[model samples]
Target: MTRRNIEGSFHLSGGDFTNAGAASSELKSILTNLGINPEIVRRAAIATFEAEMNVIIHAVAGVMYYLITQDTIKVVLNDMGPGIPDIDRAMTEGYSTAPDWIREMGWGAGMGLPNMKKNSDRFKLDSVVGEGTTVEIIIRIKEGKTE
Candidate 1:
């Protein structure tokens, strides 16, 4: 893990569709500036973008934090809203509970989590019914240093 110790946070507004992916993209740029490889940065950006979209579509409001080092990057997402009931089902490739409105927004195809899993080195999810949800993802870049 790189010893960069870079951190940033984004606030996802409730029902703010236009601002989705803004923070993720910003983090991507920062990682790129820190000399993280392009491919690794792309993967982390895509995964983080998906997670951010999930927050906008499913949760009312959310926050995402990015922690970057020379060797590793960690993204933590948290939201308070209607929690996912079945994590197993949500992990499947083609399952979604998005309403008609979200579907009209062109995002209910249920590929978010799958894409995140495919792009990230480590992924974890914690959710409670009627409570909230949190997701953690970590990506490591080889040949990078950590502190």
Candidate 2:
């Protein structure tokens, strides 16, 4: 037997809507192959997708790093861009700073942060107004959920 762990990282470029959600989709596939619970996978996918989109919509570049285990899926998104000025307002489901063009494409509906928090068992968001933002999402897998 060899030693291994389920982990991966992906990079994203700002305004690259063409590749949005790719990383999250890969995560879903990995978790499915590992026999993790579908529900957990779904939540992780949604949360990660939202986080990924956030970086694409607002940052110059970003990376998503994830670690999976028998008990949890942990995802961290780090980006370089104009950080949130008001986390509270940003967390509101209907408030978005996304430009009109993004909304015209049917995104930036202001649900990203809210939805991310909703699907994560643990959520942490930090930002510097002019620096960047970092988000961590952790989802717990029940005892029998991992095979």
Q: What is candidate 2's lDDT per residue for 1-147, written digit by digit as tens?
A: 322567889998998988888989998999888887899899999999999999989999999999986678899999998999999999999999988999998888999999999999899999998899999999997654542
- Backbone clashes in candidate 2 total 0
Q: What is the C-alpha lDDT of each candidate?
A: 0.87, 0.91
Best by lDDT: 2
Q: 1-147 in candidate 1: lDDT tens per residue? A: 336477889999767888887888898888888777899999999999999999988888999988876568899999997888999999999899988889898898999999998998888999998988999998987645442
- Clashing residue pairs, backbone N/CA/C < 3 A, model 2: none
TM-score of each: 0.92, 0.93
Model 1 lDDT, residue 24, Cα: 88
For candidate 2, report its TM-score: 0.93
- Each candidate: RMSD: 2.2, 2.8
